[model samples]
Each structure stands twice: as structure tokens, then as C-alpha cells.
Target: MFAVTFFDGEGWREGVVEADDDGQMLLREVALPADLPRLDGVIVGGFTDHHVHLELVDVDLLADSVLGRVVDLGGNVTVLGDLSARFVSLRSLNDRSLSEERSDETKRPRVARTSTVIEFAGAFLTPPGGYPSDRDWAPSGSFREIASTDDAAAAVAEMADAGATRIKVASNSDAGPVFDDDLLRTIIELAAARDLPVVVHAQGPGEAQRAARLGAAALAHAPFSERLSDEEIAVQAASVRWISTLAIHDDPERATAIDNVRRFHAAGGTVLYGTDMGNGPTPVDLHPGEVAALREAGIDGLALVRALAPADPRDPASVLLFLRGDADPLRARRLTPADLKV
Candidate 1:
């Protein structure tokens, strides 16, 4: 049996425990195998970067890190599809006799590593000439500029065909034109009909409130461009999940976002640890700065670990993270995926 000190959520320290791969939590007290990996650190379940863009990052490079999955929020459909299809056969990215699996988990887990998988949202559905529409970095088929309600439905259907587990809506009014209420509703309704949760990149004055009020499943980023009103914050916390991509921004914006998310977290909103990996310069693995930002937002201990984890029951994997330092993951120095000891 393999050995590790595991944190089964909450607060428990199972020292040097051994367990076999029987899909059950054995936690044997007996001596571990001599050739087995000695993971004496804090072992949490596999991590998932909720918001990423695989088109910009080196997907193959993620193998060595501890991250077990990544959710590609927006990217070129063909590219994303090709990538997923290529990795589809691997039970684990490492391919150690692991096999693809099916379960009751919502989006359907697809392991690409020892237990890693990449769930992708086909493209960013936005208004014509929207934020990413004109951006040089966003390639063709990466951002679909929907014209009408029916058009939006068609685009979402196309994404569904492309194997997007959820829908990503670009409601960034600050960057350029975005979806109006009617179009937004069309997209949301269509996505919901397909059982896809809509994640919005809500920015600027009323965009956050609009997305929240319209029942967005999650906000791609913490509402940052403007400070949300108490009512808006309440609505968002009550309805939307927030993907924490806090470390990429600097003062004022970063500070404002942290404050808003802190309130949301306190109000019981779900917060997933995400780095927006390719938006700027960030490591290919778990980000310590992002982890630190989450701590500063008042999410510590088990909550922090949960945020860093795949958090979604639908995307569970068999891998584990063995952090090398402090048992309290919040104070842990070895937080990056590269620093993962086993």
C-alpha cells in the first residue's frame, strides 16, 4: 500500500497511513511497502484550476505538477477539441495502467494524468466586437460574436457539440460591447437547457449585478472593476460561484476584488482557487501567490484546501497532493504544484 499523511477535509492528521487503490478510504495502520512513495506531507485530494485557457499554455508541461485537472474557460474550439481528444484515452496523464471512468459526477470526469483531467468550455460567447473579439491574442473560433438570441442559441449548441462541459459568457463591458439582457438571458437559458452552467466574466458598473441577477452559475473573476453594492454582493453571493484569480491584478483592483470576495465568502458563496493561468505571467501549476491571496481573503485551513481542490464533486480524481511544509495549508510554503512532494 502507498503511504501518506492525509487531510480528509476538516481537521485530522492521519500520520503515515497506508491505503490501497480499492476506491475506498482504507487508512491502514500497518507498515507501508518499501518501494512505495513516502508521502509524509499534507495529502489533500487532487487540485483543479477552475479557470484556464489551454490555447495559451503548454498543456503537456502540466504533467509533473500536482494539479489533477484544469478547466479551460475559453479557447479555440477545434484546438480545445483536438487537445481533449488527444488526452481522452489516458486514465491519468502518467498512464500507469489507469483507465477512463464514468460516474454520477456532473460534467463527467475525464482523467488525463495519474488522475488529472482537463474540462474545457469551447469558446467565449460575446457581443460583436466585444472585449476579446478584437484582441489580437484571441484567435478565430476562440470567441464567437453572437448577433441575436437565436444566434446565441446556435453558438451554445455548437459549444455543446464541441464537448464544452459548461458555458463561458464574456460580459466585460469595460473592454468593449457585451451581451445585452435579452441576449444574456437567451444564452443562459439555452445553456441551462443543455445542463451547462454559465460562468460570466462580469466587469464594470452593472455587469456583475446583471450576471448575478440573471443567475450566472459562477463569475469568472471576482467582481473587480467596480465595488459591488451591498445588494449586488448579496445577490451574487447567494447565486454565483466565484473563481479566485486574485494574484494577477495589482493594487486597488486587487484590493477591491479581495474585499468583495471576502464578503461573498463570509456570506457562504463558493470560491474556487483559479489563477487564470494564461491571462498573464503565471506558473503552469498551483500558484502560491493565488493561494496567499485566498488566505488574505479570510479563507484559511480546510476552506483554503477545499478551494484549491477540485471542489466540484462532479470532477473528483484519485490523485492526492502532499504539501511538504506546515500542516496548516494556509501557512504552508510548499504550495505550488512543483513543490508537491509526492
Candidate 2:
């Protein structure tokens, strides 16, 4: 038996649940308030990782990390499917086609037990020559370039048919045309028609602004490529949710990342905690730098927890989070991953 503070969709309360020999427990509303003994340890809901690439990071090693529920922002869905089978508690997938490909059929990518309950964003939609096409590390078959509004709508339908739960689009461009407003709007509308949310890769000047104006559900990274004005910040706060992938900015542009986060938080924008794991030589799991950077940007305690909580686009009411040891409720607002016990 273990004592834990359970967080249902509504609120938190003390409860006891039995764990198996593997320290695993399944929670459902039906088994609540039963007679149970005090627990040796409490597993607050599992850590919800907003961004990660489980395939790139060692699956076994990441399974031991603090994060319990992870969302893979981008990667090879087939690889993610294979990893999902091994790690039943790990929840993530990259696209619908990969999900369909893995369904009780071929088994090139064996599933891991911990890889159950994954949600995929499908292929990334970008201009013909956008940010990912040039990247040597971009996984093949992951980029879907849309040339027009009709193409955008068709792509959304195709991904939906492939069983995509969400749509991913890229607005940033390093060498070619960025998605025009018409195409962006079309993608969002089509995704909305399918009841899927859109996640956009927003960077470069005006990218974040455009995403906000176009009602993008979330931005893949903090707007670090450019400094947003107060008006722009307000616009973003009113709309798009920004995922804080601050650790990726440790390059010479660290200052930009910090500043972007500071202004975004100050403006009351939603910040989802994320580390672009596998994008470079980032830490394999709950990155202390990313947590520290969020603290530096003025998010603390409940705010930080909310940002780190795993998000389900379909079920906005469902959220989960965890903290090791007796984390000070007040100190949680200021804590870095270094301060956590596990």
C-alpha cells in the first residue's frame, strides 16, 4: 500500500492505492476511498513532459527519468511506436501513419511495454524549403510540405485518415518562404474541423506573432529568435501557448531565449515546459537547465507544475504531474531540478 495525493481532473486529495511488485499502479475512479494501509512512497501523478524525443534518447534510460508521461514533439513515428511497446507508461507518438503502420500488423519497430497511451501530431507541414528540410538531423518522411491552401486542407484530411490526433505545422523559415497567412489559417481551420489542435514551430521575426494571430494552439519553442514588443506579447498571451524549450538556446543566443521567456511570462502567456531533447546534446531526461530557466523567467510553484504537466489536446481536463520528496509548496515556485530528490 502507498499513500498518495491523487489529482483527478478536478482537484487533489489524499488517497491510498496498492502497487504491484514493479511499483506500478492503475488508477480509475471506481477504486477510490477503499481501505488501504499507509504507503512507503507517494507517486504524485507522473511528470508530464511537454516535449521530448524518446527515440533519440535512450528509451531504457529515459524510463528511469522523473517524467512519467511524455509527448514526443517530432521524430520518426515508427521508432516511437517501437519504443512505446516497451514502455507502457510512456505516452507519445509522432504521426498517424506510423500509428496505423504499427497497429496489430507489421513489427519492424517492436512496441515496448512502457510505450502505451501515445498521442501523435502526425507529419510536420512546412513550405517547400523550410527549417527541417535543410537540417541533417531531421528524420526522413517527417516533413510534409504544403504549397497552397487546398494542399494544406488535403494534408490535414490525409493525416486525419492516418489517425493523427493533432496537426503540426512550421511557420519559421531559414532559407525559403514562410507559410503565408492564408495557408496557415487553412491548416488551423481544417484541423479544427477534425477536432485536432495545431502545434506550430515558430521562430524568426514575426513568426510568433503570426502564430498567435492565426490561433495556433501551441508554439514548439519559446520565441527566442526575436524580441517581441509589448503589443506582440499581449497578442501571444491572448492566443497561442508557448512551450518553453529554453535549454536549446545555450548557444551564443542564450540571452535571446531568456529574454523571450521573461517577456512572455510577464505578459501572462501560457508556458508549457519542454526541452527539445535529441535536437542536440541535451540532457536525456528532466533537464535541470530547462527547469531553472523557467524559474528565471518568473514561473514558479503551481505555475511551473502546470506548465510541466502532460497535456492532452483532446481532453483539456486531463493533466498529470509529479514531484519527488516533500517539495516545499512555496519553494516549488523557485526550485530547479537540482533541488528535486529524483
Candidate 3:
């Protein structure tokens, strides 16, 4: 049996779980059995890192981590697609093995493991001669440059066909030319037609506000280039969900980014935990630095957990996170890959 703590979308609750008939684990709203030894940790819902570049990391290492799901914000479509298929195959094999083990009257669930789910955004959709196009880190086929408004529909269609659940638009005016208002709107409109949310890498002055004003579902990062006015912050808080990649910048900019996120979060803006992992020497699992940065932004306790967890913690299909050391909900931090059980 395992002792656990979970946020039920409203408040944190304590629970106990044990392997049931057929070798599946079940959560119970009761005390731990006195005779049974408890696992040394508290269980929460599986985590999802909303922004990652899988092509730049050793994705296979994620199999043992608590990140049950990862959203590939930008990557080579073909490579990401192949990687996604590989995880699916592994999941099937694991499930079949578990079923076979149950038939043999196994007493314990095998090692408590699950494959990391991949939700890729295919590639970065940018304008002709745009950011990342000239960068060596972005491999071939990782970015599709839309030269005109006529190209928006086709570009979005191509990504949708490649199993993209979302579209990533690159509006990094700091590097080079970015998508103008009309072209960006066209892409957003086309993406909407396919029921895909447009998440933009909004950089440079006023870029974040532009993405928000034009109905972007999310910002790939909190606006870090410049300090947003109070009106801009309110607008973003109301409509845009900011993925907290707060630990990826250097000081002055990093401090500015934190302030932006702090105000945005204070105004009731939704913040999702994300580490632009491939961009730097970031860890593959739960990042302690990112967690601490979020704390500095005033998102602590249950609010912090909500940002780190999946949208629905109650989903039985979602992976359970066994946090090892500090189990106190209010003081949860220092989460590393070793802390995770599944």
C-alpha cells in the first residue's frame, strides 16, 4: 500500500492505495492499513511539461521519470512522429506484459512503471527568413516558413496531418522578421478551423500583447523582452495561459520575467509548468529550479501542484506521481527524477 496526497481541483486530500484484483492499483479515501508497509512518499497525479524540444534531448531517458506526458512545443515533425509511435508501441507491450503477469497470480504490481505520453506540436510555423531558420540548433524539417497568407492553410493542414494537437507560431522579431498581424491572424484562423490551439513563441516588444489580442490560446513563454503595462497584463491574464518557463533566462531579463509572471499569476492568469529543456542544460524530470522560480512568482502549495499536474487529476488513466522526500503539500519542492515511482 502507498500513502498519497492529491489535489482534487479544489483542495488537497490524503488517500491510500493498494494493488487490487488483476494487479491494478486503486486509490482509496481511507487510512493506511496498520499491518501493510507503506511506500515512503505521497502520490499525486502525473505531470505534464507543456513545452519541450524532444529533438534536442535524449527522450528515452524520460521513460522512468514522473513526466507521464510531454508537449513537444517545437521539433522536427518526422522525428517527433517516429518517437511518438515508439512510445505507443512500448505502452502496448507494457500493458500486455502486465496482463500476462496478472494471469500468473502475481502478488505485486511489477515495478510501477508507465511510458511517457507525447503530444507534439509538429514544428514552428514562422515567416520566410524568420527566427530559428538561421539557427543551427533547429534541425532540418523542424520549421516551416510561411511566405504569404496563401501558405497559412496549407502549412496548418500539413501539421494537422502529421498528428499535431496544437500549432506553434514563432514571432521572434528580435532575431528577424516575424509574422505580421494579417498573416498571424490567418494562421490562427486556419488552426482554429482544425480545432488546434495556437501557441506562440512571442518575443520582442509588444509581441506577447499581439499574440494575446489576436486570440492565441497560449504563450509559449511569459513575455520577457519588455515589461508589460498593467492593461496588457490584465488582457493577458484574462485570455492567455502562460507556460512558466521562468528559469530559462539570465538576470535583468530573468527578474523582469518573474515580475511579469508574478503579476500575471496574481491577476488570476493560468500558469502551466514548463521548462524549455532542450534550450539549456535542464533536467529531464521534475525541475527543482523551475519549481523554485514558480514559488518566487507566488504560486505555492496546491496552486503550484495544479500548474505542474495534468488538467484532470481525477482521470483514472492519468499516471500517479509518488513524490519521495518532503510530502507536506505546503512545502513540496526539490522534486527530482529519483523522487518519482511512476
In terms of lDDT, which candidate is strongest? 3
Q: Rank the candidates by TM-score, best first.
A: 3, 1, 2
As a TM-score, model 3 comes out at 0.88
lDDT of all predictions, in order shown? 0.75, 0.63, 0.80
Which number leads on TM-score?
3
Per-residue lDDT of candidate 1, residues 17-55 (tens digit): 332232222243345556776654666656779988888
What does candidate 2's lDDT look like per residue over 1-342, in tens digits?
A: 444555442345565444222222333333445555433332344356676765566656654455556777666555555555544433433222333443333443321123324456656788888867777777776677888877888888877776566788877765566888887888899999999889888877788788878878999888888777888888888788888888788654567777877887888888888887787777755678888888888887667766766332113112223344554222222112122222
**Tens digits of per-residue lDDT for model 3 on 37-141?**
455666665678999998888888897677878999988888888899999888777767765664443353343355788998988999889988999999789
In model 3, how large is the Cα lDDT of residue 126? 94
Reference-based TM-score of each model: 0.81, 0.75, 0.88
Where model 1 places Cα greater than 4 Å from the true spot, the runs are 1-40, 92-115, 311-317, 328-342
When summed lDDT is taken over every stretch of 10 residues in candidate 1, the lowest stretch is 332-341
Per model, how many backbone clashes are there?
A: 6, 22, 0
Predicted structure 3: lDDT: 0.80
Pairwise TM-score winner, candidates 1 and 2:
1
